[model samples]
Target chain A: MNRFAGPDGNIETEIQKSLLNIDGGIMNILSTVIRKTILTVSFVSLLPVITLTVSAQELNALVWCDHADDKLLKPFEEMHNVKVNIKTYEGTGAALSIIEQSAPGDWDVLVVDAPDAPTVAGLGLLEPYDASTLPMSDLFPQLTEAPFNYLDGKRYTIPEKFGYYGVAYNKDKVDPEDMKTAEVMWNPKYKGRVAVYDYYFPTMQLVAISMGISPDNITADDLEEIRKRLLEMKPNIKMVGDIVSVQNALVNGDVDIILNAAEFVVSGLMPTLPSLDWNIFEEGGLMWIQGLSIFKDSKNKDLALEFVKYVVSPEGQSRLATSECYWAMPANSTTQLSDAEREILRWDEQPGYLARSVPSTISRPEIDAKMLDIWTEFLQK
Target chain B: MAKESKSLKPLHIDYTRWAFHPALWFTICFFIFPLAVMLAISFWQRVYGRLSATWDVANYVKFFGSDYLIDSLTNSIEVTVLTTVISILLAYPLAYILAFKVPKRIQGILLLVAVMPFWTAYVVRSYSWLLVISENGILNVFLKGIGLIDQPLEMAYGQGATVLGFVHFFTMLITLTIYANLVQIKSSYWKAAADLGAGPVRIFFRVTLPLSVPGIVVGAFISFVIAIGDYITPQILGGGTDILIPQAIMLQISRAANFPMASVMAVTLMAVVVLVYAISAKHMKMERV
Candidate 1:
């Protein structure tokens, strides 16, 4: 007999009679289903907590995608005997918003744009640490004592990973010589074959450099000229996108050049596609630096500091520089990288690049707002 | 007589009246509450990355004043409308065949095949489309191999590609809705029309098409609502050549943490959807489908 058959062995009639009995039939089935759904949803939502319960301690870090690599995290996780829960975000605005939405002590560690460290510290989101404890001399000299990392003579954050905002392009498609200068952004020869990286800070600064204006000296009046120059390049531009999209454009041969991108965008792919290359402009390059800091309200300050130290160590720095997501230069000059890896990162040229480039500006609110407005206009154009 | 008739009715309360309470509460909690919050936030100000409760309309004013900001809405409408029209045109015929010509046993399999695209991740689906239509993509390679042109056609990173992606997804949605409505339609109506001296074409024109209007409207309306608000499809497939309203809203939140501006854009998008709903409400028979 079928399992669902009734006592009399008449399946159709029994099922009909049962359904007719509303008290024991449809309503019961519906309520059971609803109960099961709620139970399932509740269980699924509690999964992270369940995992955390098995671990001795948990360190929650808000970081960039590079820090989420298992290779970079697993060693530290094993050493500290703690579970690391990482939530990755892009852009300072988004990171700040995440911190604002979170309760105190919810996040123990933070990785942010090095330039925004002071702004964050001002908001009382960061905890200061003693610089003497760190390998201060081992770090790239330019990154060690920037004004952004300090507030009222106290160090709030330390530089972790650094790279340049330059051009990544197909060497076969565009002249390597032309890539050396900022004016290649609007070079008529490569018109309709350029994809600009969709970050307002670096792209505007790069354009300002092309027009002989430094990023730090960008006033409200400079914006009109910048806007005109940006709009003029729209005809040459095919698309403006994030890292992945811009990378896809170069890989797929959709565009010859990716403006405001560099080794961080294409280094991972260069081994497979030899024609792909990146370089800073003759005028100047904008250096992007990421910093690591502990949250001011962190309950696990000791564990957070341990994680920070581990990230800045030679082994951690090497792992992070060649992380699965993207590759960039480590902030520590003594990081252990393979010869090929160092070559791809242009390690030998760092001193010259550092000398020629200034860290990307962290603009005041009014200037940032105006720059964003012009960027929005640029995208629409 | 009226009093006696009233007394003849059952004295027990009808419990079915409370059946819709869960749905009502769900809407109140999920929809009305969030919308209210968004409306409130739209009037606030964003100061140095934190939301300040100024209760001013500066965000809205800025949105209206900026041409580029307004362009995002226009672009969204253009893409969404094109997607809806093209989807309905493609879906109606497919739904007609599924309802009338296809065998009953195989219809289930065919419908499943049609909606199989929905099983994949939305972002993955968009990227797949990009791969198929990109410069060095299969389409160009195939065309080039056949001597179709000297230069590859620029297909990806444009409004056209965005529409293509939307049509691929939403056509299946519309097909299912229209098919549901078409199957529910009794064949007797067609036979009766035929017996009354109407030809097959005339019968379909007079009976089937008119009766299927509800399905068309409902599906088209849903396509409009979803496509207008979608961010991923356009962001990946459209290649950010032109920004959509959702992209603009994300820019505000992600780049500026300007919740007030983002909320203003959200409210505007919701208003457009509501306006479209109001226009289509008369032709809709949501429960029937």
Candidate 2:
């Protein structure tokens, strides 16, 4: 006998009897309604399990690694009776891919590159959030750039953190004076003793900046020179890597200097490795801004907006700046910091650093593809 | 009698035939369906932010046309071939030792020892290798202290590091497979060879190796497929110096959010794996195991 043979397993008992009672033509309609009702009931029964899986108070965010730190999120999570579920990605590219794969309303918050805010918003990916309650007065003057936090005169993404992409070096091995110029990047003296940041946009822009082209005004004509300059430095570069890899290169003494690193590389390590430091070259550095935005399709719009507001708040800003991923300067000017953290960020030198840096330029698709091609060639060199 | 048999068939269905249903459905749903989707998407194009359903081979053209992109596949094959060959060379001896030299009473424990490192995570194993070989790592510290060199050697980055990481993992896998093949050989075959006046070396070359081709080929083919499709080892240790096909595929998805381009590269990778399987199928009698 079949294992399922039993009174309950026999479909003919109830369903067949019901079908026999209906006329042939009417049977189809009756069966359709019955199926719909049963499906509705089954779906309703699964509601609580689904709710438990992602509770009402839970906020799902796709963001950078810094926001994943429990220390950065704990207070906010506790006070709001909510859980902040974060998926950290290294770049806006990776983050976008993650968001694309997710179901509608699956994500509540998005932390992305400040320059990408306008582009992402135009894609209808961001919710236009009111920033009236936010401590806008306490934001760093430079971080309030319209192109970054505002799109078409409306708020989309709010800058949460900002840092320079420049030279980070071990003072014991590198001459600090020589580090002041971009020329040190390709210097033979540092051959096989340098690691570079692996991102194409900022690295290419930094190269353009060195060659007297403002990042915002880089033209196709400028790329030939830029590519040549990048290739020349290949022999000197021991490795090109992301944040953690470049930091590992420096901390492990595998490289003496990171050609495109900034405070994120040395800020946390400054105390343990006091010799590690960073500086913007005379040619200027690329300013990278990270911002927070609410997803357009977020189910929890109110909660997500509040979370974004809190991230830009003074208390949240401090914790975020010192998050375990890496340390950088928080956008909120009122962030409380100890003497050591302040020293590492060089809090007093903000004006000087901002003066010598240009925020990242919004990339056009054609130009972006061209630059990526060049960068790929440089890596293979 | 035949009409009665037809009635009996309905009451006593061939349940044994239904056993293969699960595997068939699994293949259709997971493997065949996804592969079809990937293949279909490969001909689609993604222009800027827009994904067009209009079929075209621009992606495949660009993939093959770009030297930079083509180099990654070349590099992948080079690395995978070297890793598989090196793995077999190292694993065969260890497998031989375990199968022949180790006492039967303790062979299980010895085999367990061979698998001890596999218990650790694969990514962790690669990370450990990086830590051990970095310029300031123990290898350098010890070498310097022993007066081997005045300056620390660079051993932790580039293609070399990637190969070392792959070889470390694949060797263990190949060893287990080869050892299983070795022990299954009949003892009478070796006895007959010795009686025929064939020396130990001759007997090993003539009798043992010939019997073990299936295991070796199976292991090597597995190693090749896995090492070629892998993204992590090259990403973490290769230092972005050499791009592998998997990395290039991810670059499209991540950097450009270009799904069509990524799909093309993935399909290409699958084609290469299929070609490899076709070539090795003759010596790959996995059913014998």
Candidate number achieving the greatest TM-score relative to the actual structure: 1
The worst-scoring run of ten residues by lDDT in candidate 2 chain A lies at: A1-10
By DockQ thresholds, what CAPRI class is model 2?
A: acceptable
Model 2, CA-based lDDT: 0.85
Q: Write model 1 residue lDDT over A1-381, tens digit each, in one string.
A: 997788889898788777859777885788799999999999999997886676669899999999889998899988877899999998777898898898999999999998888889999998899877776778887887777888999999899999999999998988899999998988999988999888888898999998999888898899899989989888889888888999998899899999999999999898888899999999998899999999999999989988888898899999999988899999998898888888889898898998899899677787777778788887885
lDDT of 2 at A189: 91
For model 2, how does the per-residue alpha-carbon lDDT over B1-289 read when each residue is reduced to its tens digit?
9998887874567777876799988999999999999889889887666788879898889889999888888999999999999999999999999899989999999888878887988778877888888988989999999999898888988889999999988998899889989999889988999999999999999999989988899899989999999988998888878788888887777677678888988988998999999999999774443
- TM-score per prediction, in order, is 0.84, 0.83
- Stretches off by above 4 angstroms in model 2 are A1-63, A68-110, A123-134, A294-315, B1-20, B286-289
Candidate 1 DockQ, CA atoms? 0.49
Give per-residue CA lDDT, model 1, range B1-289, as digits (tens).
Answer: 9999998997887678766679878999999999999999999998875789999889889999999999999999999999999999999999999988999999999999989988999999999998999999999999999999789989989789999999999999999989989998888888889889999899889988888889999999999999999999888887777889999998887787788989999999999999999999988874432
